[model samples]
Target: MLQHSAILGGGMGGMLAAFALAPHAEAVTVVEQDAFAGEPVPRRGAPQARHTHALVSGGARAMEALVPGVLAELAAAGAQHINLPGRYLGLASRGWFPRYAGRQFILGCSRELLESTLRGRLRELPNVTVLGRTEVVGLQGSPAGITGVRTGSAPLTAELVVDATGRRSRAPRWLTELGFPPVRESIVDPGIFYATRVFRAPVDAGPEFPAVTLQSSPRREPGVRRNGTLLPIEDGLWMITLSGGPGSRPGTDAEGFRAFAALLPHPVLAELIEAATPVGTPFGFRADANRRRHFERLRPCPNGFVALGDAYATFNPVYGHGMSAAALSALALRTEFERRRKPGTLRLQRAVAGAAANAWDMATGQDARYPGTAGPGPGRFDGIIDRLGDWISASSGRSRLVTDIRADIFALTAPPSRMRSPRVLWQAVRGGDNGPALPDPPFTAAERRVLGVRPR
Candidate 1:
């Protein structure tokens, strides 16, 4: 059994890994380059923190299981819980999803708040230590196994190491330096860009204000896609993010940002913010690709090391799956450690990868459908799956059952294969009565009154 564990990066994945390993190791250290001393604030390392982030039900459950009462703590911190379909104002590729009571839900908040809360909780663990402003320069040991990590000239020895340094992880380079063959990689870039700004919540807007999303449809236009979301975050602020794929990228300037929101399928997002006071200048981010490092496929893999979070894979943040996926990975790590009397590094690494598989497929599969998407295109089997997904999407806007299934998948509570079940398959094949497409935003009288707007 491992006596010491070191996790690189103090982000969600790394901190959670520390929690997972604390029970099995005598000492667990998280090496982060940022100081966690102030009120929850955005870190330079996580630029996209300013954008809208969703904590799906599956991830929320996993986190609650790990830390116990974390969800309640998050709620106390002003994170909003939005029930899927029931309280959401969403326009999907197919049509506006009908507002109905939902079984699944998502937590809406700034990334900074979520990470800070988690960090605070982690600090309470007696055996877990977070080393801030410490950069991991390299890994220690050979290609066969890692013994520790190198921080500049100093070496922190540990029996196990986890790489959660996100997209900037240098694990491949470090492994190559140790004479290991390069790991294969898969990348899919839809060239998605995001522009976000914060606005004071309108006077009438309340905690019950539904989160709004205008989803882009790849099937509608190959290279041109634009979407927007307005999430009510803490402190009576609405975080609005406008996004586009390739040809329709949003700009960083204020005017351009507003223009992008206006270009979405509906003008509700733009109109909502038209008279509202801006809290800050518009910020822009570019997530160039969804990249996966095939570490699980490595033969004779290193014995004492594994990669987690964005170190293993990064998805287009538009899907809002990253944080949740990290939580699931942490849960997987805990499970493997508990199940095995003596968990091998390779076995644990594979288990972590398995935890991330569903999210990877969900994000990349949809991104590949867009035109100008780089990297390997969908395979023959993937093409078949795409057709089925298209059918579901088109039908979901009309059929409540299909909509529920899609919502479940989006919340990460159900696998994509659930749609292939006999009942759902029969529904898909027989085609239910899909009501007419919504002509305008489906805001209720109360919601409209809160926004100070009338029904279109």
Candidate 2:
């Protein structure tokens, strides 16, 4: 077991990492720059928390494994465990999805609630220390490998240092200062801005109201692609997020937010938001770029340091995979530590890095098609993959077997490559589901009554 370990960042990823490392280490320290409030509220450090965040199945399971019973805590806090495909009116690029039923699900709640729940659960662990309101300035060891971290007052030495500092991570610069080579990185920016508003859910909207998702097709004509997602969060409120690139970026005004939603691939999101009474002012966020730091590719990756979560990779939030990927990486950290019974092992870093591979592919593959996407475009083989993805998305709505597999891939329970498998490819080729595409939002009669959506 490790003598001691330090996690830099007290966000969900950092806290989850501490949970993972706790059983394998004598003591765990989670350092963060912001002091969390006693109640579940968004912190100044996590601006993205104001927007809607989804806890996909992959992430939910990982979070449960590391911090048991937290799901019940979230539910008790008013978060809805909305089933995926089953309780979702998802509009894909090809067509609307027929509500599917299976094992996959996501937690619909504010990021602050998720973080607060984690913070609460973490308090129960006596061996863990949450050092908040402290800034991490730099690294303390040589490039040979990190030995400790430098904070504002004193350096905290640990057998292992994990950087979960998020997208703004300074690990690369800190390593360079330690005499290491520059860390290579890849970024794909869709120039998209997200605008979100909380609505007082329709009076009759029950706890089981299906989540609504509108997806944009990036493979079409080169122009602004718009998308929207509305889900039932805590407090009997619905959080609606509308997204668009460049000129089409969602506006700050309430009218513009609804307009953006209306302009999406479909009008269901727009219609619902139009009828629901808004609880608060509309807000916006723009740091949704997908960035990846090639830490694993670093020769003999720093012996005592590791990076996970947004520090290692970030995805377009619209894809709703960031938290899940982070949780998976944390789970990987625990698995590695238990197996090796040590810190900073080569296997650990690689495992953590590999955990984000599927999310990276899914984010970049879709974002690269945007007209003004920053950096390089998709690989030559991406076109083929896109075609296969479209077929799967279209067929899943009609085929239960195909739908189950597709749902797993999106939920992160299954690798995206599974869709490319020979058997899956054969299924796609032969067309698994046989039926006409859904022509409109597939809302059940009960759901229609709740949302005031008129039946066809």
Candidate 3:
């Protein structure tokens, strides 16, 4: 077991690292630059917490495994555990996805609630310590391996150090300062900006269930791709998120937000907003590019050091995969520690990085397709993959078999090879021959009554 380990940042990812490491080390310490109250309120440090976040199935299961009963705890605290496709309506550029039975689900809650739960859970771990209001100055050791970190007063030295300090992490320069070569970065900026508003979901809006989503195609006229989603979150609330890129972002005003929603490819989201009462002022943004550091590629990764979450990679918030990927990465870290008592950081780094593979690919793939996206574009080989992907999207709404496989892949629970299975390939070949996509969201009479929308 490690003598001691330090994790920089007390943000969501950092807290997760503390959980992952608590069992593997004698003691774990988390350092945060900001002060926060015990309540589940927005922190000055986590401004993005005001936005919408989806705790996808794979990550949800990982969290449950790590904390054992945390999901139940979250539900008791008002988090919405929603089944995929079954409990939500999805609209792609093609058409609406038919509500089908599926194993995957997403937990809909504000980012604040999730992070607050993590923070509270951290206090339960006897071996973990959180040093709030402490600023991290730099690394304590050389590029050979990090021994710990330097704070404002005393330098903290440990056997291992984890950097979970979100997108604004300074680890690259710190590592270079310690004699490592400059860390190279890969970026795919979709130039996307988004806004979110929480609404007191109308109790009269039918039984609390299935959320709604309307998305524009990246394949649309090479410019701004407007999209909107309305999810029923905890405490009878609907978190509506509208987003796009390469142009004017949706405004935060009540009228402005509703106006933006009405501009979506479908009027479903707009009508729903019109029916509900606004709870708070709308919040906006998520412009950070889908950026990643290929630390795994660094031959002989520093022995006592690694990065997780946004420090390792930060995907566009629109995909809502960041929190889930971070949870999975912590799980990977624990798995590595279990297999070997004294594991090398290089392989361990690879394991942590692997957890993010599915999310990274999905976010980068979608972002690249948008017009005016920065960094890399889809390559020539990707052209074939895009066609296959489009085929899957079009068929997913109709074919249960296809939809299940697609969800598995999307939820990061299955490998990409699942799509290449004989059944899937056959479905792809059959294409739209199966028939028309769901022309309208498959809502029941009760749901239709609540949303006050007629069938298209």
Clashing pairs in 3: 87-210
lDDT of each: 0.82, 0.83, 0.82
A best-first ranking of the candidates according to their lDDT comes to 2, 1, 3
State residue 88's C-alpha deviation in candidate 1, in Å.
1.5
Error of 3 at 243 (Å): 0.5
Per-residue accuracy of model 1 over 1-456 as CA lDDT, tens digit each: 577899999988898888788887888989987886536888887777888888888888888888888889989999998888877888876667888788888898888888989888898999888888888989889966889999954689988899999988999998887777898898998888898999888766767888899887776655677889888887778899888887888878889988888888887888887745688899888975888898877766887889998999888888888888888998999999899866888888888888887788888878888777887887889878777767766654467787788788888777778776676777667664567556676788767765534223
Return the lDDT, model 2, position 403: 65
- Model 2: runs farther than 4 Å from truth? 219-222, 392-397, 450-456
**How much RMSD separates candidate 2 from the native structure?**
2.3
- Angstrom error of the Cα, residue 398, model 2: value is 1.3
- lDDT, candidate 1, equals 0.82
lDDT score for candidate 2 against the true structure: 0.83
Q: lDDT of model 3 at residue 303?
A: 74
TM, every model: 0.95, 0.95, 0.95
